[model samples]
Target: MAINNDVLSIILGGGQGTRLYPLTESRSKPAVPIAGKYRLVDIPISNCINSDIKRMYVLTQFNSASLNRHIKNTYHFSFFSSAFVDVLAAEQTMQSKSWFQGTADAVRQSMHHFLRHDFEYALILSGDQLYQMDYKLMLKEHIKHGAEISIATIPVNAKEATSFGILKADKENIITSFIEKPDAKLLPDWTSEVSEEMKNEGRNYLASMGIYIFNRQLLIDLMSNPDTNDFGKEIIPNAIHDHKTLSYQFEGYWTDIGNIDSFFEANLGLTDSIPKFNLYDREQRIYTRARMLPTSKVSGTTLDKAVIAEGCIIHAAKIETSVIGIRSRIGKETTVINTYMMGCDKYESLDEINKNKTSILMGIGERCFIKNCIIDKNCRIGDDVRINGGKHLEDKETDQYVIKEGIVVIKKNAVIPKGYVI
Candidate 1:
């Protein structure tokens, strides 16, 4: 593989993912299970690997141990080579600094790290998006156009456009106007630039993918600008006129798995009759840390549009449109639907009373029934327990399980007693 010494990939994986609720209460969004097989962090890391960009760093905070372990196991570089991947955490470099304040601040905090490396461009991306793109092509375009900053923008529906950072690009593809999230009327008329079919195909309004290719020195200079401490809210909008920012029009499978609906939708998208996003391309395989376990086994169970990862045992359970994480056990007569079960990973390094036990490892309780809920890592549920549509009862103040938006959240390393209904 040829090395692109001028580029360094920086992935932002630290967001709290509050909107994803039950799924993110204990772990960061990047570590959240996706399609029952891979973590959200796998998306960007897989993209970088497939794009042939090896030098990468993931910036993370807020329950990052699982995320860090996933990255360490999934992304391994040869010791004989100069190219490598690293995960960066918020650490006190000096007595003055404490933790990353924002995305811009996260990058700003790593100024010293990149300062030692000689890279001409920095490829910044989000860890919580499901998309497949050839970033090498985008980088080539960035260098060819001599762009100070390049943003990955895709057309999204106007009705759903307010959820993203909307932009207005000129005829030459230069970004002229930018808004984090605009009202419907305030959005630019992308119809003229795109086709009606595109709009119908979930494409019309240009939305930022939260992916950027920044001229290294220019980004450093921009970060040094005390007036700006945020990217989408401040620096990006501020760079509209002063910088040669270009919008790279991307039309492909792209979904921001930021909220619960989007997260659930993205997971369900994987089981589409003809999935929009393909992670099984042999030529451009999406790589993740292998669990080194046997493939999942189902005994007299029925699975419909579900994703079951390795080392899982489904015993006569009915699973539909859900994602089951690693090392989980689904008992007979149990039903799981539209839910995300995050299994216990030894990599999480949480203290557990059960050793190498599937139920104890991922925090799932034996014989418990989960439905339309998100069970966080390392939760122990006792036999014959009912999740009740994954709904949580708010009346119990001292109880550990909290429900948000009709989704029940079982925190990491939690223990639910036997026969108890949550």
Candidate 2:
């Protein structure tokens, strides 16, 4: 089918992002760096672009400056074309003076702006997720089923199902019942008819992917009510019986980057021999900002399963199962394992580097040993610093870093003194 021009995408930027703290301390959740160079927001936007859905609106509230700047710098189209990506920050308006209360309320507050556009459907997506999907296929299924609302569902095991909103679909794939994060005891009754492969893997319950396609009119009618604040918790549950909701089952590499542990694992997972979320797919390309940066220069580094971005100057002793971001500078004899080092924003001048010879400098320092950690952007690690994250360490939060679930997250622009140990 031809590209669907009748749909407008609305990417929801999550609130606070306290779970992914330290990383989200300065920037919004969507603006957090992911998979070496790309930001988290790039995933859904790239998916939309690949599906030929150009126009998109990103709704955000806290720390939206970086997200706004990233979107503006990355997504650009011809002036003659209708393609554009805009950021809508929460504002006090005549209709509503409060901030976005929940997922549904965020769209409701911005409905006026959406109404000005000419579209038949609204594709709502979460900003903090890692997955690639052709939204066109879901749109096609929505139309074929004559669905008022269509939710992308994935078969998840009972352990994982309790964390998401589960849906039970009828023989026609029409959603009949909905429960928001059901109890473990309710798993048997909530199991849906998934494929044989999913069944064999003990993934029988259908969990909502938090991706939805709502008919424009139906969305408008639903938004008129101020009571329904969240889609999964309130709207979906109430509308399942009344509306013709279809569950578009998707079996792919989808993971919700809700917390620090998940985010850390997701980045490290990319260093796998064959990652489930393929970034090398020629057809399903992941788009990001086009920077005019030089190629990375590696010398004497024994790299193993490392994904390094452009403009890096690496001389580390060894880097295994790590994602080194753009403009990173790793000094000699440093060992980074199972870590994500979000590189610097800009290169430090030679003069500046020389002046800081006796002080902490940007990127990993010499003789440092960092393992199972996430070094945020522009971090300076002095020589001989050691951070070994594991279950032995208890969860704690410092001014410069945070240790959650045994994963150390160095805050953005933090400076670790020389010879420091954790």
Candidate 3:
């Protein structure tokens, strides 16, 4: 495939990720695991890679070590090639001595590094969205419309419109107005002309996907202003009137992984017979770290609608509607349902396993019944544990786990003792 060397990709690693707490407690939003194997950042990076946008930089501020390591280990281009994916964490320099304030600020702070590179357009993407898009197509549209800036817009229903940055575009797909998370009462006026299929589905409002393309010079010029800290809240809304900003309507599957409830649903949704976000598409392959791990070995486990990754040793009695990540260990007589177990970082050796037999061992132990939960990586879930997460349970947090919107999230590297119940 002929790569788009003219466009440089800039993936924004979101601030704090407080809504996705615990998952983002130790790591940044981009580093959060998804689909049992790949990190959240992998989605946009993979999309860019698959779209032939090779020169990229991932800008992050908080908890960036793991994200940095993942990018360093996963994306490796030839030395001869200019294609590269680099992590640009917030640093105190002569110009600035603070962390990234917002999405635009992150890009602004990293402009010095970006200015060194040669590119015609800047492809700004969110690190935590789940979708497969061809940037080449979007780029072609931007050039066709002679747009200085292009924002990817998706048709969203009225119920969802209030939660997103809604916009109105002209007949020629040129954006005229923008609103940041408008009130439900104002939705009727914000509706854009979507496809017949989208309109039939009651998806009339065009919501910004937080995906944008800015002409190189415009991006650099925008960064010069320190007042604008966010793209959705500031930049796009202001730029629509001044610039020839085109609204590139996308009718593909795209979900903003903003909080725990949405994150949980997105992961579990992959267990569907045919997921909205297709991971099986050969053309749009999701790139990730290549681990030399053995194939999963399941014994006596009756699996149904489960997406189990490599290096798993499952002896569970049954696992339904769940995603078991790489290097996971499920002991005998365990029943896992509607859960996402992030799996272990490293395999527990036979000696270590024997030593921890009396104590809590890595992964879900024997006779456990876990449902509607997110078991973070490297957790030690002891024997006879029962965690049934649902609306019946109120939101609360403990040292070991957190229950938000009734979904139990076992913290990463947490140790749940024997006979524990939630």
**For every model shown, what is its TM-score relative to the native structure?**
0.88, 0.98, 0.98
TM-score-based ranking, best first?
2, 3, 1
For every model in order, what is the number of clashing pairs?
Answer: 6, 0, 0
Q: How accurate is candidate 3 locally (lDDT)?
A: 0.94
Q: What TM-score, to 2 decimals, does candidate 2 have?
A: 0.98
In candidate 1, position 387 carries an lDDT of 80
lDDT of 3 by residue, 12-51 (tens): 9999999999899999999999998999999999999888
Better of 1 and 2 by lDDT: 2
lDDT (tens digit, per residue) of candidate 2 on 316-346: 9999999999999999999999999999999
lDDT value, residue 374 of candidate 1: 67
Cα RMSD for predicted model 2 = 1.2
Q: After superposition, how far is residue 326 of candidate 1 from its true place, in Å?
A: 1.5
Task: Give the true-structure RMSD of model 3.
Answer: 1.4
Model 1 TM-score, all chains together: 0.88
212-324 per-residue lDDT for model 1 (tens digits): 98988888888786555678888888887898998898888888777876776677677666789887777567777776887777887788988777888677367887778
In candidate 3, list every pair of residues with a backbone clash: none
